[model samples]
Target: MSVAPVLEKCRAEGRAALIGYLPVGFPTVEGSIAAMRVLVDSGVDIIEIGVPYSDPVMDGPVIQDAAVRALAVGVRLSDIFTAAEAVAGAGAGALVMTYWNPVLRYGVERFATDLAAAGGAGLITPDLIPDEAGDWIAAADRHDLDKVFLVAPSSTPERLEAVTAQCRGFVYATAVMGVTGARASVGEAAGALVSRTREHTDLPVCVGLGVSDGDQAAEVGRFADGVIVGSALVRCLTEAATPAEGLTALGVLARDLAAGVGRGRS
Candidate 1:
């Protein structure tokens, strides 16, 4: 259930992997699970099951609103595992993308055990750096879960080396320097960062932050090993008048993004 095989398969096929993100318990836990199914069925390779937090520092307004909605309705840390279980059952390699506090509060050992039991593949900690993540590292290793850490455009060479060294599934390359959101253009910084990070590790470098559509996904797929879309897909669900329409919009976008990934060279 490791995510590495999924990315490797995509690489073997000469295409970039399509990684999608959505906060768990958004719209509703059930709706979020349904959305992930649509994403996978349409074209997502790895699914980032965002564990909604009260304080989501790395997120922009779109994700922040969604997180707030989930929290307002009482989405708990345990509920994240429930959502992860459903997403995994739906046949996607599910990874929990959460801030650090929740893990610390939930107990790293307990979190890892439950996540593994739920059939999740790994974790994506945006606010936690690898150097300060010894406990999580130990727990993840104990459960054979992937450790996916972030390396931003501003990360220095030494910092990039440290982060990517701890990464297992793939390195999360934050393409944009600011908060996460959809943008009209994928930055030149993204390519530069991917090149810089590549100088350190052979792990797949997946670009995230501000990728809004298939065209942008294609643009990023050229240099990145994977393309991650968050705000755009969340917007499809959040802005839709009904849950069914939301799933339909998400599927259409996922199809387009999947095609975008294929447009890239291996």
Candidate 2:
């Protein structure tokens, strides 16, 4: 379930891959799984199955709200695997996005083992840096799971090189210097950051943060290997009046973003 192949396929087709994010157990566990299936059918190449944590420091209000609701309904760590299994079954690479503390609490080796058994693509640990990820790195390697680390606009040349070296599926390039959310623009520094990251590693650099619509996705796609979207997508569900409406909005936005990514090379 390595995401590299999906990104590679998108590259072969002359576009960047669409990486979508949604928290497990949002609205409901089953509802989230069904929504994720809509995303894949609508055109997301990879799905980042969010593990709803008590404290999501990197998340914006939209994602934070969803996480709170998921937690209120008692979403467990195991729910992440269930969602991942469903997403993988739908034919999209499933990667779990979680905080390092939860993984530590769950036991790094056990988390990795369970994720792999669920056919998850890998882990996108926002707060876990390579310098302190010795245990996770070892566990992920043993489980054959991809390790994705995030690099931001403020990252130093040395920092960028160090981070990208530990990454497998793709390097997550944070377009802005804040928490994750959709913005009018993805920021002017994104392209420069991507260029700087490429200086260190040959891995595909996917940009995230502040990308909301198809235009924004296409804009980021022009210089990125993939476009990572989260808050905007989550909002589709949170802002909708009904469950059916939420799914419909999710599908519409996903399809639009997919079309946007495809226009990147054009």
Candidate 3:
């Protein structure tokens, strides 16, 4: 994935990449795929196809509710490959954000191979820190897959160095300490965290969690390489009464956030 080439493109164009997150099989596997196409067409720089996990510890209530609905329908691992293929075709790099246990159960080597064949850019293991990710690291490398690791604001300088050193695409910087959700305003600590993380590596660091609107995207985009929005987009689909409405809302949010990425601090 060349360290997430889509992100590099956005940087060349003079903007922070806009990364959108949607859990696969949300409304339905097909419905989620359709919504993703809308997001890609509307200028989403990257797509995070969330693999629905029973115990999504890092997710907030909105995402947890959506995942529960998907799981109820028996949405399996294969469904994610299908979603990834479709989303990748829409011109946005598709990466799976999943918990460690599911990938472990599916077999790391097999999972990485299948994901590469499905045109996936990589994996984002939210619960699996780099220090304990030896097997995943090897598997991803063998398959030429990008492995994105998360770095929290609380991480020490040494911890940040270790995490960034292992990260392939971009470092997922969790803006807040808690689980993911929309917030009114981004905190000052987020910028400081980005600053602290930059001291460790030159790789792109993307800020996620608690970002909901364009203004907040612009705020984070000013200092980070990318802005990741998840709960807000999921809420859009969850609130929609029909697929048409959902897709429409998704496009609207995508465009708004895309615009925000280019409007970062002067």
Candidate 4:
């Protein structure tokens, strides 16, 4: 019921939980749902569903394309909740990630209410600044939803303290300076970033952005609480000729990444 319990279970098992990201309505609502089911079945610990918006400043080319396709199909906040509900009904936990504009457009209280009813464990508004998050943060708290925030290598001690204080669910530590995608290596900067965040908060720190393979996931798991993979998995789905093929590819990647993180923790 709570993300804390799921995270704790993974920690107790000595396994680094896999958090997979996908933009809602990439191929279509149906295709996204199918992919989500496959990821859950393949042992993903948590799902980060991207709510498509017109302007996605932080997203890279891969996620941006998916969001644009989703919007072209008329994907809205309501549709995102519907998809999340389906995944939750299938016994999977999820976190909805979106920019703040969509949340404001939907009305904070109403959006939070829908998300909670849909069985979402948390919300991640990457563009939500800590100083300006009171309204939605209050709404999320009222609905008992975890409000997750991001911290970067550039965050100062003052900024880290502020983010840590306002953050719940888990802290997302960006592994690179740019948008999301896979890279050849996790890099020393990411390791240093996680270490700095650890000094500011005891909460779980999940490293994301540019993590493409099990080896990278394993490497990140060595320093962070969890590992997040996005573009590589999305690319796999995008290349699939059919939904079934896409699901198959996603499942294989999830399994391999899970196994990689498991080995690292062991």
lDDT of each: 0.91, 0.94, 0.90, 0.85
Model 3's C-alpha root-mean-square deviation from the true structure amounts to 1.0
lDDT tens digits by residue: candidate 3, 175-255:
988999999877987888899999998889999999998889888999999999999999999999987898898889888
Taking all chains together, each candidate's TM-score versus the true structure is 0.97, 0.99, 0.98, 0.97
Question: After superposition, which runs of candidate 4 have C-alpha atoms over 4 Å from their true positions?
Answer: none
Enumerate residue pairs that collide in model 2. none
Candidate scoring better on lDDT of 2 and 3: 2
Query: How do the residues 35-135 of candidate 2 rate in per-residue lDDT, one tens digit apiece?
Result: 99999999999999998988999998999999999999988889899999999999999999999998999999999999999999999999999999999
lDDT score at residue 117, model 2, on the 0-100 scale: 96
What's the true lDDT of residue 76 in model 4? 67
CA RMSD, predictions in order: 1.1, 0.6, 1.0, 1.1
Model 4's alpha-carbon lDDT is 0.85
Clashes of each: 0, 0, 0, 0
Order of candidate numbers by lDDT, starting with the best? 2, 1, 3, 4
Tens digits of lDDT, candidate 4, 118-206: 89887887899879999988988899998889999899989888998888888889988888877888799888988899888888888
Candidate 3 stretches with Cα past 4 Å from truth are none
lDDT score, candidate 4, position 223: 78
Alpha carbon deviation, residue 31, candidate 2 (Å): 0.6
lDDT of 3 at 229: 96
Worst 10 residues of 1 by lDDT: 83-92
**Residue-level lDDT for 171 in candidate 3:** 91
